[model samples]
Target chain A: MTNEMMMLTNLNCPTCAAKLEKATQALPGMKSARVIFGAGSMNVEYDPNVLSQEKIRTLCKQMGIGVATVVPGPSSDI
Target chain B: MSRYNDWLIRNREKLVIATSGSLIVAAWLLRPLGNTFHFWAMTLAAIIAGYTVAKEAIGRLSTRQFSISLLVTIAAIGAIVIGEAWEAAAVTWLYIFGGFLEGLTLARTRSALRGLVDLMPRTAKIKRGEELVTVSAYEVKAGHVVVVLPGESIPVDGKVVAGRASVDTSSLTGEPLPAEVAVDDTVLSGTICQGGYLEVVAERVGTDTTFSQLVYLVAEAQEQKPKVQRTLDAFAQWYTPAVIMAAALVYLGSRNMHLALTFLVIGCPGALVVAAPVAVVAGLGNSAKHGILIKGGERLERIAKADVVAFDKTGTLTLGQPQVASVTGFELEEERVLSLAAAAELRSEHHLATAILSAAEKRQIEPAPADDWTIEAGLGVVAHGPDGEILVGNRRLLLSRGTDLTPEQAALMVEHEEAGETVAIIALNGQAIGLIGITDPIKPDAFGLVKALKRTGIKTTVMLTGDNPRAAQLVADQLGIDEVRAGLLPEQKVEVIRELQKTGHVVAMVGDGINDAPALAIADVSIAMGSSGTRVAMEASDIALIGDRIGQVPGAIGISRRILGVVRQNVVFAVATVLLLLAGVVLQVIHLGSGMAIHEASVLLVTLNGMRLMK
Candidate 1:
């Protein structure tokens, strides 16, 4: 029952120097994530049992171009 | 900005100038009569009188009476024939004074309508490649970022993408409170950024912006009253010929030129002609002062007859803001649930998102930052924290993630949805924790206005809205509306109005939008939420409620009916008295000066009756 998507951190913007900001979405297999729009970076919160962190990064990369990196949230057991 | 309206407004001034100039020339030529003589004054009076007649050509023509110019000319000729040189001069000069007074009154009205032009901002700072370029507000567009310094008007309706500020929306909403907007919060054009520098991404600019559209719509509505089919239609068609025939009959039967002349003066139609327009102008002017802009005399006349009233539900009968109606879930505290949801939605910008954030703030719940947050446009937001993953959005977002819901929770959602409530779900990790119900509450006076209209013999009160049937019906039921037409787009709303009209119902549709414009234009009398800053709705409407309150709709109708009643009373008295006095003149019982006295009395009587609308 541990909410796993909240622990992700360490991000950068793909397009500019703006820092990554925490954002929320109602997407499946992920509870929360940090997004850096300018640098195309995402730090996702999810239960690895339902969605792997790698899959979260792929989802972020496919959603928009210029995605730089995807890191695990704080709660994630990296 | 159509060429016609431009020409009309521009030419209106020119007409005044030409008429005044001609009168001055006539006055100068008559200097032989001496500076103090009435003849010189008459010349100046003729010019001012000429413009008043010319400015309202359609109004004069609508009543089918001899122009005020012709009336003054005839009076002067009569004085000349009577060898009363001073009398001719006095009458001409008095006519000019009256015309000048009318011109001044009308010029003030035009200026009032054009007041919005002064509010346009001089320049906007557009961001390009880290360098800012100054441009006029009209040149900005969507997606362009603009920097707004303190005390500057927000050049367009845009979101604060960076920085924070306190914005005063009082100019648009008339509310005294200043709103605090952070990143992603939307601000409208014309609102002053009170403090702090904020970079806004322009969502709408120029004519497409809300403030410009608001002024434009008001101007458009103010012009909808065309001069055609004036209330004097009946009198205009018959009065002139009737007067000529009556004069001929007097000359033939009495064999007296003086009797014929007396008949002409007595049957002058002055009272009859002035009665309709003065009442209309007064009614229109009074409504404008009350924030209700009636486009024309035709709207006033139509409203006087409209019996079926239709309403647009959202923002019209309801408060038009989403609020948390109820919270369901016992496992976690309500405050904690709201805080979690607000934290997740902090980065999002949506009407419903703002409602949730405001709800949490009302409970004194301070939201803690979530480790990771993502917002799905048109769905919901999700947050990841050390405890678990939380989901907050509509049903689709929950189901797409394979998130299971308890049968009881599912039923509760259905119940709220059926009643037109927007249910904001809160899920902790993968399990549903609670749900927040949001709805736009109905206005307090909505039901009262509906019942009042019904009691006044309005045949039907139909509710037409773009919202779902459940929500629309809920609002309609509360207001005791007889019928509900739900889920109608703007065009559909207009079509519904058109259909009702085809069935012989004189329908009035009340709405606020560009979408509502078509329906408003098609209705027997389109009433717009003039106070709500819906420009398209106001522009498309025949009548706009300056206060944006539904109560004004019925109040306007009441005023129109009362004004019409007075108009009818004056019409009957004026027409009957004029005919009877003409008969008396033909019989040589009424003297010339006495007839003029009575004639002036009738004109003054009608004018005083119409002035009651000013109260």
Candidate 2:
């Protein structure tokens, strides 16, 4: 599994953030997904064999959230 | 048609607001004519506003995720079915308007990180052989020479090889003073060259530079959820569905579908979900702006609760650099004694050795080459020099080596030690020749720092040091410290911290040396001073004060407390608003439109309240 952090724009509501997180995590080949409401960013872990990063981006766009930038890394948590 | 679709996609929220608002106005204007035109206009307004809400609700429902959008959608549909078109339109419009206001305020809270990103120079001028090539800042590599013109941001962290200029380092160190850089002086990325041209050999590029590390750390810190936020999130997971169940129960019991829908409208809990995280992000960003790197929200909470602060003396309260205060020679000149001591300590790496070598350098006295030099831990040094065997250390070292001191010499050593100066005895061939007093001066602001810590609710301030009791007492007395633990080894300092913790005090250990590492790690919160240039200091502590000033400690703690206050206020305000709105719905005083307006207003209020910590 590979982890990536994507900067999300127009992600304002916490309830919507939670819904987005659940939707992204349910995607095929996904391992985990976390939406940080305060920073307006998302951390996703997925398998390349079953899904592509572009597909994940498309999924988020479908949910009305804009992806500004995507960088590969494990996100740090408090 | 595709261009219009693109415009609609880009300005979806604004279009919804515009269409619904115009239709509502048309409905009011047409009410004077006939009921047909008025009803059609009102229906159009409700549909336009409800369209976006319904789309989000359906999208979320397909993924088995319950959202506030779903609740709002259900309320708007119930209103339209009950022939309350104005209520449906107002509810959707106000919710969208509140979201727009929330987005604006949230952006302001995150502006600190945005400002840092904006400071990065996009392009750099690099020297490629004989040609100067302009490339992206990230493209510059180590060993490449970059030219920075006056009034331009330096593109990479490097050492200057030519020219001189004063560079503004406020973005990095938070200090307004611009540092003067010349040949061999290190300059950081994101600092602006105030004047003159300089060529710098890049040492670190891209994410490896200090500027990048700082930005990355701050961003990560802002994203990390605090314990309170996590708990709230867990609560929200069950709370949303539970509210939906309660609304169903209300409909079954009261047989009032409008009241049940109103219950769903006010039950989103939007404000409570966002309360703590927003405050934490704003607080962390504000602290970073002042050059105080709080590791995370957990550390920030610990700092706010720390009541007892233990400080390591050397390199923390004192300058750590010892200088020769006075020298007394017996049966030899002071210069002769200093020369012999410097010769014996020439190859030694001890702190006292540096003081002696620097003294000899000042006097233009060359130290004789020493052979077979040996160090006694916690004592001093012994070496075989040109002038037979030479020894320099404490009086204990002299006695251990069978070197005898006269009554007068012993008296002088005692007097110096009592006066808070470290005494080093110089012995030649088992005979004491001189006594040198080394003094590590207390930091200029140490007294004020202690006073400030007490004023800021730090109950017990203790000083822990490896120096003798007299020396420690002198420094403690000057600083008004509550207690002093002197003559402590490295492990003993850790023991002191452990003891403080056992007494039920939340402790914070402040230090800057390797010996204080254990104590720093043992404390509830560890803070390192003057950590801008040292990676070890940055990694060793929970909070790293980039500058040498001791005042930043209290400043950091103050920020943490203010953040905690804001978080408490936000949570209380959010929950209270929810409870009050529920009461309003139960009494039939609030309708669907007003409930959403109040709900959105509370979320915006929580966000704006959190942004206050940025100051």
Candidate 3:
């Protein structure tokens, strides 16, 4: 199990924050999820054995959250 | 097909609002066709507009939570059930459009933070023996040698092991000038190595780097609500339930459904919910861009309200590096006195020691190495040389070492002290031999800072230093400070701050050394100036000015005051708009569509007002 914090886009309305949190929490292998709309960031804990950062990124992308932060590549953008 | 699906999902809110809006207009244009078709058209528009609202309400309701979405969804559905399709269409359309506007504003405020994140390099190139290997920046451990070529940003905080470069430190210090770095000079992460091949041994990697810490600090700072935000939050907690009850009472008293539904639309706490957070985010983001880190909104408030600004003289006001201004020899010639003091101070790392050694070097006086060298902390240094035990420090050192100065020597020391020159007494074998007078050059920015603070409504400006009273007074006079309290130890500085508070002044202490840490802790707000190089200074201060420039002091205060002002304006505007709309609805001057339009307009207006806080 590991915990990671990353910036998320489209958290414009504070009301959307709870919905995003619930959607993220319902994902497989996710232990907990919290989206801080004020900070425009999210902190999540999950079992890496059943989930990966890429899978988490995919989940956010599907949920229409903006670009995932901390992706490893030539450019800083994921 | 998948890409199209993704686009649709991303633009779902906008698309739904547009579709529902066009359908409502079409229903009006084609109303002459038939009553049944007209009714169906209006009902279709209502469903399209209410789709997202109902979805959101259900999602939140599943977790046993109630929100504005639930209230909006209930009101929209009730309007449709009561055969008022036009009211249903207007309510859901305005509500979703308002949400879209808020999301856009949030993106604008958070983009300031995004700029910092973009500056971070994801990967670092490290040297493993002879081969250069690319690795994640977080995986690069401390003590590993990281190499950077021309035009690349430094990936870690470390000392330069080899090569020379002029690195642009604008990102960290906000100083546009490129600093020259040779062997042994430390460099921070996020600074671009403009032109050089440098091999730096990493001292701080990943999250420990200054750039990373700044990103983390700023993100957290944006989340910190001001005192007014908390009070408004408490008011909002009771406000939602009160609005629900108000809506029910209005419908029961007048028996009018349209007027009651208008209350639900206007009483959503639309602008009030966004006013404080947007202002706080914009304010913190603006200051962070200028390399000023105000820890949070609470600290931002104290900094804004600080009436008195007390400065630590050495590094904060003066340039901190002193020069050998004049030398006096009592029992020996000046040359002999200089050589004795220089020998004992040659190996010491104190700023005054460098001055003594450099002065001796300029005069062609060679300084031999000394043994039994021990630093006496704040007092000075002691060592044994060819001329027996040599003591070099201030009067406190002499008094503590059981040496008393003659009246003539004491008079000479006062002469230099009165001239704003630091007197370092040199003694050999318990006999006072000479006093080497050194003067630290005051920063040019410090000259008009006092007047600038006054212009910012600072009630008092004070200079607190461990230097002698006469030296401290001379600096205070030059800076035109309101008060001078000198000859104080670290703990004594805290006493001064406490007394300032006792006299009903909210004091802000500015310093950059360990000696000032205690005082910085006790003040209403502590500002650490010139913190790009000092870890302790940043850690001790509530607000850290990354650049050494004293000019930022006023700029920091100006930004804080502007933030406080903007947040206050937002709160007043948010609250007033709500009360005005409520009155308009009671007088029946505004209907459902018009009230929703005015309500959403106020929400968007407050957000835009808050965005103006950004640079």
| Best model number under DockQ | 3
Please provide, for model 2 over B225-280, each residue's C-alpha lDDT reduced to its tens digit, 9 standing for 90 to 100. Answer: 66787778777767778888999998999999989988987888888877987788
Task: Compose the digit string of candidate 3's lDDT tens values, residues B1-615.
Answer: 989987887788789888988988998899899877777888888899888888876775685555677777877887787777777888888888887877776777677677778888678899999999998888999999999889889999999999999999998887888999999989989889999889999998886787776676666677667787787767666776788899999999999887887787677777887787777778777777788888777777888889999999988898888889998999699999999999999899866988898899999998888977999998988999777999999888889899978999999999888787878999998888999999998898898998889999998998889988877888899999999998999999999999989999999998985788888889999888745466656755778888777878888888889888888887888889889888899889977777777877887888888888887
TM-score each candidate: 0.66, 0.78, 0.83
Off by over 4 Å in 3: A1-3, A22-34, A45-51, A71-78, B25-42, B57-66, B324-351, B356-416, B423-437, B530-541
Q: What DockQ values do the models have? A: 0.01, 0.28, 0.33
| DockQ value for model 2 | 0.28
Give per-candidate clash totals: 34, 0, 0
Off by over 4 Å in 1: A1-78, B1-68, B84-94, B97-101, B104-111, B114-245, B342-354, B364-384, B391-432, B443-447, B455-457, B466-468, B487-499, B514-522, B530-534, B545-548
- Interface RMSD of the predictions, in order shown? 27.2, 3.8, 4.9
Per-model C-alpha RMSD: 20.7, 5.4, 5.3
- Tens digits of per-residue lDDT for model 1 on B170-247? 655554778899998878887888999899999877656766655543434433332322546555556655665776
Relative to the true structure, how large is the alpha-carbon lDDT of every model? 0.65, 0.81, 0.82
**Top TM-score: which candidate number?**
3
Docking model 2 quality class? acceptable
Total residue pair clashes for candidate 1: 34
Report, in order, each candidate's fnat. 0.00, 0.26, 0.36
Among incorrect, acceptable, medium and high, the docking class of model 1 is incorrect
Candidate 2's residue-wise lDDT over A20-62, tens digit each?
8989989999988888766677878888899888998888777
